[model samples]
Target: MKSAARHAIDLAGFEAKFRAGPDPWHTLTARDEAIKRQRILRALGDGPIARILELGSGNGSNSQALARRALKLHTCDGSASATQLTRQALADAPNAHAWHIALPAPLPGHRYEAVVIAELLYYLAPRAMQRLAKDVANALAPGARLVLAHHQIEFPDNTQRTAGIHDRFINALGRSVTKVRQFRSQRWIVDGYRA
Candidate 1:
């Protein structure tokens, strides 16, 4: 199959697998992430900070955590149901904005204190990756912080190998890459990039 078709199949498989469990992975994953997410959230700083945005705001777990701190928080996802869950979960909270965005598109506006994109990049094809990266980097202010977590390569495959190498290449496209010492279920996290 072509790479794009392969990715589509992969995503379909993911949807079916996760959809098997009606509530999906976000909840259990969030509970597992609770402690480390605290560290990530704290790194973004305790605000009076105006705004924070979370990409792939799955099940609204992490976004809700952020709404507690930021003056205003925006949560976005490509999926309508996911965005709906985000809004519903955050409805009781005051400082929350939730939206369903079509990916590979530029963020609606720039200037945010921090952005979290957890496990979102690999879903895009390589062509889309560059566009997405450009949009993300351009959307940020010079020193705006980004938190990027990836698909856990618990065991490697050719695609995973390419993904790792892609990270190095993408890192160079921006100013610098720094490895963040953190744990999200033994997966790696990278923090702070000019990109």
Candidate 2:
């Protein structure tokens, strides 16, 4: 319960800043997100993905856009308000499921062709993040893809602190590793996937 409380605080902090106004970093982050999401989905080739799951949908801009094209989707956040705002913003996409999910659980138990996670992974504690990565890897079906992005620096882990072991452990999995963008100053979105 203590860990859950702390995770909620992290989510709340991001949600609070998002509620403040249209943030430029978020704007820049959105641009990068769009490019990566498109590239990955396209790279998966021409097919409408059946089921979609997202770890942090933020304002739901990405989910709304994806759902319009006819894909079933579920998105969750640690912040209740994030879910509230996402539902409101995504009213147009009736099939997109929005919920609140705490960390280190079974995770969203639905195999997906593609799993999308944006900048939220870095906020997790190292051990918690490990559980998340493994859970996500197991949740994906063969030929499935996991799109992960983070505010990466030259160091490992995140801006909060560098944890190379965790980062390397994630990299060691059977996944493609690459750098995405630097829209938000020094932060880079690193991607991993399974063939």
TM-scores for every predicted model: 0.74, 0.70
Measured by TM-score, the strongest candidate is 1
Candidate 1, lDDT over the whole model: 0.62
Clash number for every model?
0, 1
Alpha-carbon runs more than 4 Å astray in model 2: 1-9, 19-25, 28-45, 153-187, 190-192
- Report the poorest 10 consecutive residues by lDDT, candidate 1: 154-163
Report the C-alpha lDDT of model 1 over 1-195, residue by residue, as the tens digit.
533323232444444544465357555366556665665675564455576778877667777788887777887877666677788779888888888785667675577766777766666656666677776666566556666655455322222332463364355345443444344445545443332
lDDT per residue as tens, model 2, 1-195: 331122233655666766775342463367665665565454334567777787777667566765654378888877666677678777878778888776556766657876777666656666677777777767776777566555555333232342343354355343543333222234454454544
Q: After superposing candidate 1 on the true structure, give the runs of residues whose Cα lies further than 4 Å from its correct spot.
A: 1-22, 26-30, 46-48, 154-185, 188-195
Task: Please give the RMSD of candidate 1 to the true structure.
Answer: 4.6
By summed lDDT, which 10 consecutive residues of candidate 2 come out lowest? 1-10
